[model samples]
Target: MVGQPSAYIIKKLIHDVETVVGKVLEDRSTEAAFWHPDRRARR
Candidate 1:
């Protein structure tokens, strides 16, 4: 948005984003695994 971000800030931002995305996906998959019998078959 402004000037170039610092390396440490960039790394922290990326790490935070990945952690959020990974947790969301993990939770969704766990729900699907528990509720969807054909999930693996469809995959």
Candidate 2:
């Protein structure tokens, strides 16, 4: 790990966080946890 540059590690972390946030945003079911109406059931 020490062999990796700081910029590369930061970029990887940002990419991973974006991937997860994008996925979670795309899925409507997750809304129920914050609000009501599990809209994912419709699809």
Candidate 3:
């Protein structure tokens, strides 16, 4: 029973980390696109 709770906690932590990393990558990509010369020239 104890192992089940620990396993659940670990899974949740892993999921949270993955979510954060995905968000960071998405934000970086958006920033890169905005600063890209072709995109900037259109503005």
Candidate 4:
């Protein structure tokens, strides 16, 4: 296979992408919970 990535490379790429996406989702949810005006009103 010319120019094809190995299985390890593909797995690493997928893992890296999932880590980044998970972090982004976690940050967004944390920010929304902390700063949403409607949620703040309940306090």
The candidate scoring highest on TM-score is: 3
Candidate 2 regions off by >4 Å? 1-4, 29-43
Model 2 per-residue lDDT tens digits across residues 1-43? 5787997889999999989876786685566445534554554
Task: State the C-alpha lDDT per candidate.
Answer: 0.74, 0.71, 0.76, 0.74
| Ranking of models by lDDT | 3, 1, 4, 2
1-43: candidate 1 lDDT, tens digit per residue: 3465687788889999989876776779876566665874587
* Candidate 4 lDDT tens digits, 1-43: 3476697788889999989876776679766566565775677
Which structure among the candidates has the greatest lDDT? Answer: 3
Off by over 4 Å in 4: 1-5, 30-43
Q: What's each prediction's TM-score? A: 0.55, 0.54, 0.60, 0.56
Flag regions of model 1 displaced more than 4 Å.
1-5, 30-43
What lDDT does model 4 reach?
Answer: 0.74
> How close to the true structure is residue 6 of candidate 1, measured as C-alpha lDDT?
88
In candidate 1, how many Å is residue 29 off?
A: 0.8
Minimal lDDT window, size 10, model 3: 32-41
Off by over 4 Å in 3: 1-3, 30-43
Candidate 4 lDDT score at position 8: 70
User: What digit string (tens of lDDT, one per residue) describes model 3 on residues 3-26?
Assistant: 599888998999999898767766
* All candidates in order of TM-score, best leading: 3, 4, 1, 2
